[model samples]
Each structure stands twice: as C-alpha cells, then as structure tokens.
Target: MAGVSLYSSPSFSVLCLAQKQKLHFSVSGDNQNVPFLSRSLASLRLNSSANPLPVCKPFVTRFSDSGSSVAESEPDSSVIKSELQSETLVSEPVKQEPKREELFAVVMVGSRQYIVFPGRFIYTQRLKGANVKDKIILNKVLLVGSKTSTWIGKPVVTNAAVHAVVEDQLLDDKVIVFKYKKKKHYRRKIGHRQPITRLRILSIAGYEDYPAVALSDIEPIK
Candidate 1:
C-alpha cells in the first residue's frame, strides 16, 4: 500500500499515457484532395494569361489646351514687332531733276548765211559777179537770228548796212576758150577777167528789235 498499484487493463493505461503525451502527426494521405486545389490555382493562372494587364501610354500635352505650353512654344511678340518696324522703315528711291536748254542764235549775210552763236562772227569772200561796192548797197538781209530761212523773207532790215571795198581789182590774164568742129575750119574764142571785193559787214542794226537778239548778239566780226 505504501509503494505501488498495478492496473488490470494495460491497453487502457497505454492509451492514457499516449493521451497524456499529446502526440501530433503530419498528414501523409494520397494526393486525392490536392487535384482540386491544383485545378483551382491552374484556373487562376489561365485567367491571368488570358486577360493580360493594360499597358500605360505616354501623355501628350497640346499647346492649345495648356497656357504654359503655349507660352513656351510661341515666339516673342517684341521680336515680331521689331521685324515689322524694320520693314516699314525702308527708304524710298529719289527722283532726279531735268536739265535746262541753252540759248543760241544765227546770223545772215547777203545770199549766203552763216551760223553765229554768242561772241562769234564770220567774214566770207564776196561773190565773184557782184557789182561795184559804191553802186550796190549790201543792205539787203536774207535772215537774222532764226534757224529757218523764212524769218527774214522779203522784209529787209532798213539799217542793215554793209560797206565793201575792192580788195584785189588787178586784171587777171584772160583765159581763152576755143571750140572746134571736126576740122571744119570753124573755131571760136572768148576771154574775160573777173572782179572781186572785200566786204566789211559794218554794223548790224535792228538786231535789238527782236528780244531774241540782244546787245550781246553784236559780236565783233572776228
């Protein structure tokens, strides 16, 4: 009674002892339940493969929509204004003036005429068959200060005086003229000398009558 007690059911005692140990065991059964879990995971994987995730696209900022984007993209207004001003400031071409016409004149002497500008005159030899100086008056003027011959037509300038003296009146040797008719004993001869005079156009009057002919028109006959 003081030492030990013996049990009649040994198996029950062993069971009790096992209970007291609190034994735990990992499941080692066949993979019969695993197929359902595997199938569920496979289904999940198939679904993920079939419906892939959407990819993100890059964002595009339009100038019209955003004020900051517009300001940064556009050119400066001050530079544009300066370019316009430069174009407007261009200079125009200059026009040149026309030239003036120079004045001049012409003079007439006897039947022949001569061109005479300011400060110039001409003295030509008199005609061969002209009459004696004292008998013939050289007052008749053909033209005066006009380009055309019709200026001094029939109206002679009354004071248009001219005096001429015989320069070389010595009788020249008579030149003989002979005409023969094919040895028909017919011949003819004639001889004569010519007279000449040196005319000094004294003073041209009535030149001042026309405003075109001034005191300056009377150039010394040089």
Candidate 2:
C-alpha cells in the first residue's frame, strides 16, 4: 500500500472488475443482463396523412369603389405620396452656400484699426454722433487685400474707403476693477462697461477693380 497507487489497489480497481465482468458475460452470451446498447435509425419520414403546415400568402391591399369619383379619390395614394414628399422637404436641412473670397480692407475706425469685409459686422469704440442706420465712410484705409492683388498705403490709402452703417450703439460687458493697499488696508472694487458701436460693413470700395476669386480656384491656407 505504501508504494502502490490508489487506482492500482484491487479494492479501488473498479474499471478492471467491470471489464472482466463484461468479458465473462459476453462468453456466456448473457447480453440481456449486461445491457449492451442497441442503436436504430430514427424515422425522418414526415406524415403525409396529417394536415400540412399552414402556408402564408402575400398581403394584398383593397380599395373600395362607391361609384362616386370624388369619394373614391379622397384617399388616393398620390396625395399620400405628395404629403410624404412635402414632409421630407420640410425635415431636410437648408443647404448653405459655399464661402467665396472677397475683398477686405484694413481701416482705422478710431485709434484702433480693424479688418473689414462686405456684409460683415464689427464692434468699435462708440462713434460720438453716429445714429442707427447712418452710413459712415471710413477713409483711413491702411491696406486693401484681395486674392489677385494688394494695395498698401504709406500712411493711409487716399481713394480707398470703407462704407459701414451704424446698427446699434451698445455697452460692452462689464470689467471688474479692484484696488488694494496691503499695509493701509484700503480696498476699492468697481465695475465699468465701455460704450461700443455695432457697425455693419456695407462695402469696401477702391478694390472693386481687382479680379474676383472663384469658389473653386481659392487656395487653401497652409
């Protein structure tokens, strides 16, 4: 028992005993007691005498005819199709036009200079007497640039002018100002909003003679 494995022991050797018993049963022809497996092919033949599975038929739409043309055509398919088409058109997003290169000018509105283009809006320091819808022509154009050519002035372009209309005079966002003195314990906090004017650029003149760039010919910025 010290050197032998558990399976090799006669008391634990169940497989050997079963095999010996099977061989002894086979020699004695006692197959019924041994219970050997008997395999028979399954019957795959379906019953022709039984009712067949129900067959599904294609669905068919029926329209009623009441002898009146107006009543019969009220629920027409064409009307439904047109309604669906209209719904689809309403749901579809509007296609935006592609952006094209336009003439731009660098003009000085007040002490600060701004780059302006036609139909675009800009916010500048409040014009003193400018009112809403009042057109103002800016003559201090430092540079005018386009796709084909550029015009740069020494101090300011003479003929170059930018026309803009005052859209609104509004106050800008508040800026918090805080003053502090460490030793004296003096603290002051205040907020200020600078008055600004909104201007819609109507046109940039003097550069209309330059060639306009086509949408496809515009080069991508590197």
Candidate 3:
C-alpha cells in the first residue's frame, strides 16, 4: 500500500487549529501518519493544561450613610455566625425584676383593729364626719413588721402611727335578714348594706428605730 501522509493535509492543519478540543479522524489508507497525529495531540494536550484564564468573581458592594461606597468579598464564616448569634440575642425576651414587699402594720381605726400595708387600700367602718380625700392619722399601731424586724406594742406602740387617705365612701355588699315562725304563718325578709370608707395606707412611721429580728433566726413551729 502507498504511504499516504496526513502531515501535509489541509484537514490536518484545520484539526490543529481547534485548541483545547477533542479530535476524531479515520485513516484508511496507511499508518504512516500515526506518529505525527500522536505528537500533535500530545502538544495540544500540553497547551490545554496550561494555566487557566483569570476568572472574574463577583464582589459585595456597600454604601455608607455619607454616600461612600466600598467593595468587599463574602463575609467570613466566623463573622456571619457572630451576626446570627447577635440577632438571636436581640430577639430573645428580656427578664423582669422581682417586686419587693414593703412594711406592714396592725392598727386600730375605731373600735376595731385592722392590718394595713403601705401603698395598699382597705375598707373600714365609716367615720361620721370623714370625707373623700381626707388624710387620717391612726396612732393606735399594735404591731409593725418589715422584712428584717418587727415591733410589738404592749397595748399601743408609742410614737408609731399609720397614715392613710380616704379614697372613697361606698356601701358594702347587701346582707339579707330572714325571720320565720312555724305554724304561726309569720315571715319577714330584709336586705341592707353597711356604709364603708375606702382608705389607702400611705406610710407607717416611727417604728424604724425599733430592733428587728432576722427571719432566719426564728425557728419554725413544731
């Protein structure tokens, strides 16, 4: 068979022009061009494996309140994680503080004694001449108590007083009275509400100098 060479063929030159591409061809006449094709393919492979073209990656652009702009790459993992953690902390609910209890005392208002605390309100038997917004000084303190200590009066604590203001003059819930007599066919019913005065305890004074007993020092009842 005649040795037909592809080295000088026009098609061979066209194949070489295609850089970084696969090449397929059928050589039926002879194998004389095999060495040349192998050498050309090897050279093409080496050229394809050269350093790749420079890639243009996207960037993040930020604008400040002053109209200044800056470009930056993607945020670091640690920075992004910290931002998420800060958001979670901000989204959480805030805790509320516990309310502190204030001082309280027992005092006699009229014929009856009553227990009262500062900043609290209570209803008592109506005073004949007392009007709403009238300030009353109750000087019959029997016991003064606080979180730290307590003071007890023999009958009434001297120099101790409970200050209160009349908040309202109102009537209490109705009380029903019923009378029945068997076989006499007599029955009577009546409903009535007692008049009462609402007083807001303002302050308990004159017991702060007294000695106090710590709660831990007291033993529980057996």
Please report the candidate that would top TM-score against the real structure: 3
lDDT of 3 by residue, 152-174 (tens): 88876778989999999999999
Worst 10 residues of 2 by lDDT: 37-46
Q: All models: lDDT?
A: 0.50, 0.79, 0.80
TM-score of each: 0.29, 0.51, 0.55
Off by over 4 Å in 2: 1-101, 208-222
Q: Flag regions of model 1 displaced more than 4 Å.
A: 1-137, 146-151, 163-176, 210-222
Model 1 / residue 118 / CA error / Å = 13
Where does the lowest 10-residue lDDT sum fall in candidate 1?
23-32
TM-score of predicted structure 1: 0.29
What lDDT score is found at residue 153 in candidate 1?
27
Top-scoring candidate (lDDT):
3
